[model samples]
Every structure is written in C-alpha cells, then in structure tokens.
Target: MSDPGFRTGPDGVRWRDLNHNGVMDPFEDPRLPDAVRVDDLLGRLGLDEKIGLLFHTVIETGPGGSVLDGPGAISKTGTRHVVVDKRVNHFNVHQLGPAHEAARWHNTVQRLAQETPHGIPVTISTDPRHGFSENAGASFSAGSFSQWPEPLGIAALRDEQVCREYAEAVRSEYVAVGIRAALHPTLDLATEPRWARQLHTFGQDPQVVTELGLAFLEGLQRGRLGPGSVACTAKHFPGGGPQADGEDAHFPYGREQVYGGGHFADHLAPFRPAVEAGVAAMMPYYGMPVGLQLDGEAVPEVGFGFNKRIVTGLLRDELGYDGVVLTDWELVNDNHVGDQVLPARAWGVEHLDAAGRMELLLEAGCDQFGGEECVEVLAGLVADGRVSEQRLDISVRRLLMVKMQLGLFDDPFVDEALADERVGTPATVEAGLAAQAASVTVLADEGGLLPLSGSGRAVYVEGLSAQDAAALGRVVERPEEADLAVIRLAAPHEPRSDLFLEAWFHQGSLEFPPGLPVRLRRIREHCPVVVDVTLDRPAVLGPVMEAVDAVVGSYGSGGPALVRALRGEARGRLPFDLPRSMEQVRTHHPDQPGLGDPLLPCGHGIPLGARV
Candidate 1:
C-alpha cells in the first residue's frame, strides 16, 4: 500500500525511500501506524544492523560543524566508519558549532545514512546545552542556543510555568540544529550537598523535582511524541544522589552509592512522574548500590546498568516501563583520550571482560549502550549463540519504534536557513536572561543594604569583570577607594587533578579556603560588602555569610543577571538548604533532605527591598 503523498526516486521530498527499493515500503509510509511501520522495518534488518541499533556512542563534528572524515578529539572513529561500516545510527553530539552549520552537518550525516543498506536515519542526542557550565562530560555552554540559568536555578524559582517555558526554549533551539534527543532534566534529587553533579539537578525536594520535571518533560515533548517534539531521556534514574560521601560515581573513588538513612523511597519518588509521562528513555547511573534493599529483597550490588533486579525487575516489571533503557556513558569499556585512561565504570562487574559486561547489560534489559561503538563484540555474541538472536530482536524493535515515532523515516533533513533564524533569537535570549535574574536567591541583607542606589557610587569588585561592574557604579581599583564593595564567589570544592575527566568535575569539600573568609572580612571593614556566590553545589558558607554584609546565591547567572537581582528587579528563593558548617554536612544522611542544622533552610530567601 503505497501512499501518493510520498515519492521514491529523485522527487522524494515529503518522504524518504529508506530501503531504496524504488517504491514506498510500508515502513516509509507516514500514513501507517508507528508500530506497524516499526515491525516492517524490524523484519528487514540484518543481524549486524539490528546490533548497530542498540549502541548509542559519541560522535564529534569538525570545526565549523564539518563532518569528521577521520578521528576526532573525542570520537575514535570517523563519521563514515560509524555510519556505513558499523551501521550505528544513534549518536550523542558534543561541542557543536553555529546552528546553521550544525544543521548542515546533520543533513550530511543523514545523507550518509541514506546510502546504507537499510537507510536508517541517525538519531542525534545531546547533554544539557542551554546553561552556563561547559564541562565536556556533563553540559556545554550555550553557544548559539538561548541561554538560561542551570536547572538548579529553575528549581530555585519554584515555578512550574517557568520550568515548562525553559524546556520549550531548549526544545526549539535543539530542533533548530537537528538534534532529536535531550539527555537531561536530571530528576536526581540533590540530597547530597557535596555531590559534584548537582548543577543540573532540580534540587532536594521530591515534590518540586517531580512537578518541575514533569512540566519540563511536557514542554519538551509537547502533547504527543512526534516529528515536532524532541524526545527527552530523563536520566540517572532511581536517583543518582546520595553518593556515599557526596562524591560522584564517575571516578573509581566514588563508585559506591550508600542509602545510609534508608531514604531510598524518597530518592525514587521523582522518577514515578517521568515514567508516568511516558518519557522516551531512562539512563541508570554508574553508582553501584552498597546496601540497597527493595521490598525485603537485597538488590544486586552492581551498577544499575548491569543489575537485572534494578533495570528489568524494578524498572520494567514493578514500574511497568518498556521504554528504551540507555546505560550512562562508558559503562562497558574503558575510555582512553590521549595519555589519560578512564576505567570502564563497571562497578561491581569490573572483573568481567567486555563481552561478559555486554551480555550482563543485555540480560538486565537495557536496549542501548551509551558511549560505546563496539558493534563487532555484540555481533560476535549473537554469532556464537551466547546472546540469542531473539533477545537482539526485542531491543531492535524498541529502537526502531522510537525512530518511527520521531518521524525520522519520513523526513530526516533539517532546513539550515530556518535553523539560523530560529536559534538564539532576541526574544528567546530575553526570556533566558529574565529566568537567570529571577533565580538569584538572597540569603542575607543586613540593614536593607540591597537595591543598590546606582548613584555613581564607587564600587570595588572581586571575581567580576571591571567592565560589568561599571554598569552598577564607578569601578574602583581598591576597596578603600570605593563607597561599597561587591564580591562574587563560586561554591568551593577541593580541586583534584589525578585524571583528565576527574579534573572537569568539581568534587570534594564544600568549605571555603581558610584565608578566603579572612580576606572577605578585611574587605567588609573598608565598606559595606555584598557577596554573590554561584551555588553550583551547596557550599558550607558559614564564614563567608558571616563576614559579608549581604549574601546572595546564584545558580548560573552572568553579571547582568546578578546586577538585576541586586537592584531589586528580580526575586528568588533557596531550592536546597545551606549547611552551617562542614561538620553539620557530614552528620547529615546522604539520601535525606533538610536533616542537618541548616544555616538557611531550603525555602529561605530575602526580597531585595524587603526589610530585614
């Protein structure tokens, strides 16, 4: 049954003839149901093609958004090697160029895919890109996309509507550059303050996280998952928070996840909303459970990706989720970039070989492997009859169904001209700036010292550019020469430089350096000082808060947003608690929320103009 709405040969505009049979196959027809189309495509796939569909690996675009014909900085293989040779269609892109160029590059990749035997279009995914952080493994700084505050900032506003609007902006920008998937809206509750990955999470409250996460998911996906929607892969499922001592599971030292307070149920609460919303995919974290028990049965102490009891028994059977389960990056094989080698985060399964790890993950019911391009290994498993062809078919069907639902088979190419116009428009930029300013939380304001009367008062600034400070008042050389001083500090973390990837993560102690508070106190003596701290991770700001006259918390705001907050043009509230001391932080449970003697509670915030 060929649909007249589509063409097969040179005139194929509305729909692509994926199979290249010179006729519109059932899978190519947009008029048919997605499940029927998926079945038709699944029946035609060879063993290698089916196996290729199950691996979602990293791929880098060349400088100026050109397709990499050879090895890239991150990607070991070239574009042709992954697409044509390996037949892998799913990719997670990082460090993209301008929107138009990225769209052109995407079209080029699709053209390559069209030449393949099955002509399956590539599904491009990306980490959170519309924020301030530029960590290679976590998120990219918003280049061409509309920039907003981090997810923590959005959580600080505590507005569902704002969450929805922020996600809508993300979707529009991503779709413009031909990206089909979002690897975020990190539902993990920031229960552990020292955890390095808290910048992207929605904070500690289950209710707020669930509400905001659902709204964000709804906005990204719209009503139903279709051509216009960007499929969201709500991640680090069953909670990635509660890292043993606030250390990330990305490194070997922080591989254990301990539920010390037995607040495991609280950690799992937010994911129920994501599952209920029918999210396109779920990514399990790398942390292996140390002493996790569910329903009176002890869960296997392996990484969630390789734990059948967690992935299949808990996520599939208990929660009734059948969506594509993608493992977090580098779970199976070690990653080597230059002289640095990051061991595979196999956790409890570290003793297993590559093939052994793959088989276990497949048994655990994960549909795809993230950050891996070893197609030959999986093909060998099937060929040896170790992993059955039937098991491979189950995952292939799920993968194909998603592509069909995304309307990739119908039309995969993006309009480069439309992309340039839609991305980072003036209005979107304004909206993002507003959100950033609105999320600034005022923790302290002694004697109503805020809403700085911009009466050309000489201002001494630290951690802020002199140019940006000029807008507030006269930028002075020293604190003694200024009428008032404004200081900006990032939430402190003990720096680690052992591994290349570990250096990128801000892990370790939340306490400020001993000399920092003393230095701040000296500046306060010269003039009334207002301090702004970027709370990427909740820091133990007892001394700094005491030394400064006014203290404000910023998630990921720039100089303009900080100025707006200080000028009483915007308001914000705390999304998570601030501990009085590092000892208080240590006494608290990793999985519990608001347990310690907080200096300022979760809902604490002062309006700039409000009297103290």
Candidate 2:
C-alpha cells in the first residue's frame, strides 16, 4: 500500500492552483508526503517553532530521572528550551503504563497537541507496551497498554515465532492506545555481565538478534498504531552492552564502558542488523568510547552523542544510516547528582556546554535532542542564525516524515478495547515468565545437586521477593533464620560513576559494600551457601566462589525464574557467560569466556521437565 514516490517531498497529490496564486497549493491535495507538508508549514513559522521538535525532554523524578509512567506526578521539570525568545510547539514523550488506562493519558496528551496551531498530536512511545514492564522505569501503572513477557523471556525460549508474537501483542497495544512508536527489542546481545539492561535484550548471538529484532520491528511498526503499527526507535545504536568494566550508563559510582582492548565489534554486531531491518529511528548511547570516536584521526574523551566521528562518521556515514538520531538523555555533565553519588566521571574530556552539545549533535546528523532541558538555548541559536534555516527544514521534514509513516495524520483516537485485549494476554504473560525461567543461568550446583526440594530446611533469603524465594524451597528473609542463605541481588539501580556515566564511561573500584563477601563466608560456615546475582554485570564473586556451595545468575528478573532455577526446576547458566570474578569480567568480557561453574559449565541448562 506504500506509494513508490513517497520519498519525494510530494506524492499522492495532484498539483492544482488553489486560491489562484499561480502556484500549486497543498490546500488542494490528495495528501502529500510529510516532508512537503513540513516545508509548507515551516514557510509560515518562526525560528522557535522548528527548533522545539528537535528536543525530547524527560520527565524525571528527583534522582531517578524520568517518572515515565505515572505512579504520581511527572518528574524533572525544565529550566531551558532550545529557543527562549518565543514559545514553540512542545511534545511530551510518555512511557505508557497498562493498556486499560491509555485512554485517559491519550486524551490528556491529545488535548494538548490539538490545542497547538500545527496540532501535531503528540506521538507517545513506550519501551514495550505489550510486555509487562512497558515502562522500563519501575512504579509505572495505569491502563490501555498490554502487558506480556519482556523480550528476554522470549529469547529464553529461542522460538522466533514467540518473539514475533511478543512484538505483535506490543504493536496491538501501541495502535490501540494511539501511541505511534515503541522504543525497544534491545538487540544488545547480552554477552557480558555488568550491563544493567540485559533482560531487555536478545541473547548474545548476533544472528538471533538480527532475525528477531526485525521480526519485532515488523510486528510493531509494519501496520497498526494510530492508522499503522507503532514506529520503533532502535536503541543505543551501534549497540550498548559492552560496558567498560561492566558498568551501566545510568548508575553513579558505576562509571565507564570498559572495552576488553579489542572487543569493540561485540557491541557493534547487534545494530547493523537493526539498521538493515529499517528501524524508524536510532538512539545514541550515553557512553563515550575512547577508541570509537576518531577525532580528526585521533580519539576523544567525549562520547558518541557529542562526538562527530562516532555519531556522524561511523553510524551515519560508514553504516549509511539515514534515520533520526536521538541522544540518550542529558549528555551534558550532571551537577544535579548530590550526595547519592560517590565516584565522579572525571576523565579529562572536553566538557562542552549544554548549548554546544546540542549544536554538535545536530551537526553530527542527530535529528532529535533527547532528554534535553535547554530548548530555549536551541531557539536562541536559531534566532541568532547560528543554526541554519535550511538545516531546520531538513530535520523537521524528516521528523514529519516519521509522523506520517506512523500514520498519526490518519487515525488519532485511542482504542480502549484494543489496548485491553492485546496487552497482558494470557499467552504473552506466560511467555515472559518462561523467559525468566529460561534466562536463569545456574552457575554452580555442587554435585548434580539442585532442585533443593525439601533439602533447604529453613533457607535464608537476601535480596529478592518472598514469593520468588518460596519457589526455591524453604526461604527465610533473615540471614540467621536458615540452614543456608541464598542472596538474589537487584541489578545496579544506582547510576554509574557514583558520580555520572556521561561524565566518564569507564571502570571504577566499585563493589557490594566492602568485605560483604566475608560475611557470606560466615553464612557458608553454617551449611551450603547459594549466591544469586540479579545484576546486569557480574558482581565480585571472591568469597562467593570460595565459600558458596551453589551460584545462580540472572538479569532484570525479580526472582521468579531465579526461584525456579534454585529448585533445579529450570536449567541453564544464563545463555551468556558469567565471569570468574570482577577482574575476569573487566578483562575477558565481550571477547573471551564466562566463568567455570560446575553445575552450569558451558552449554548446561537443557530443560529438566517440560520440552518447552
């Protein structure tokens, strides 16, 4: 149904001299390309208007950044806009909660979008609306969006059809709620530990990631959000999971994207497929690679978002990506992080000002400035003509093109019925739980010794849910209450650098409270000690390796699967690798091998009971 000449600025339109201006007018159109309409709209607009659409502002709640889905009020208000002199049309990016409540949120946003002159109905995008945690940020709850399994759950099954189903369910949720896009199917290939977002990714294999990423894309955006399926913003492009020293970009004290000397390609693998698959947009990562950005034939300390070599050269030029480039939140240094931070991301990099960062990103072919607060500054640049009118037209036209492609101009209302039926379907939710079950990689089980059924008399639990712990056998929350203690860590919620990741994307001497492992040694003194990590990156397993009788690993899971694995009900030592220690992780990750756990050797977990 796609028009062949849709690439042209005008298509499906018969030129006619409406109003007799002796010029062809859109007023007499059979609907043209969004690019043409964009040009038409810009002709009558001021400098401020075009610049506003360039920034994707965040809704932060104190330290957590954006409170995407509402548990309460929206977080993080702004002090600056790209253009300050005049007010411009603004669009708020929202992460939907549940499928049922989408009607209310859609109406609220629609009212605001409709009131504006251009009436560009705000395009809402979520992480994965059909999945349980569409709002990646916890605490998000509402209605109208579906809830299925997370992508990792699907990957665990390794069933392509299931993955497509996840995408379809999510797409249905997107279209139903009037949300025109979804930002995910993380294709990150979670090969390493320490990267906080592995659960959202496909496995560590490139082929799988490529095949499924496209399938998910087709499922979501091929045809049905608004008038079509929701669009996708393929993220952290050029891939994000080879964390330097396995640290996350968001957590403070968790600074750095440690590269194992030559493991760059591991990170690059997933993205190429996404681009080839024709993702609507690409997101730049928050980490700045020292080797990736060749600054005039040399490397720079600043990251890709601000680095031309990485953003413009490698991604846009070398790869030939023509999609919208969105920055991953505030790229400027964080002065807002107060006591919560311990370490600081202070690498002698060129600390560009906020305004300067914006200018550079645009110059580097970035279409939208995500997580921006300095919209007024951008407006100033446009007003002063530092930013060319020609450039604005190009970016705006492309942006509008995406909107039209998403069919926002065709259908605008939220379909409450669709949201409910598609999201949180019985099959999808089961699949997510299955993914958790499948992803739980059992590292050590002592002597073919797991499925602790009745063996763990009064087992002590640390870190996860009581319900999840109960599945493992006898679970006790207090350390002293059980014969053996099993700890399930929550993935690093604290931003890296203990200071700021954008400030410095590399390694630090981070740990789980000094000598905390020694205490685990004492727990091992009682009977058998089982340690399970729920972190994206592998935690230091010094005492754990020596003292614990069993070990298990998981990412982004709340313990449902970990509990299943603990009972030996589930099989597999995370389809990826588990480093021997923090040292091995820092050195061998993204390139070498996972650690040596007896129960979960190399190719271990092979479904204990069910064939599925």
- Candidate with best lDDT: 1
How many clashing residue pairs appear in each of the predictions shown? Answer: 0, 69
Q: Which consecutive 10 residues in model 2 have the weakest lDDT in total?
A: 1-10
The residue-by-residue lDDT of candidate 1 on 251-308, one tens digit each, is 8889899898999988889888788898999999999998989889999999989999
TM-score of model 2 (CA atoms): 0.74
Cα deviation of 436, candidate 1, in Å: 0.7
**Residues 227-306, model 2: lDDT tens digits:** 56677888776667666655665553333454554556666776887677677778877666644433336545555566
Segments of candidate 1 deviating more than 4 angstroms = 1-13, 609-612
Tell me how far the alpha carbon of residue 266 in candidate 2 is from the true structure, in angstroms, after superposition: 3.4
lDDT of 1 at 193: 88
Clashes counted in candidate 2 amount to 69
Cα RMSD for predicted model 1: 2.6
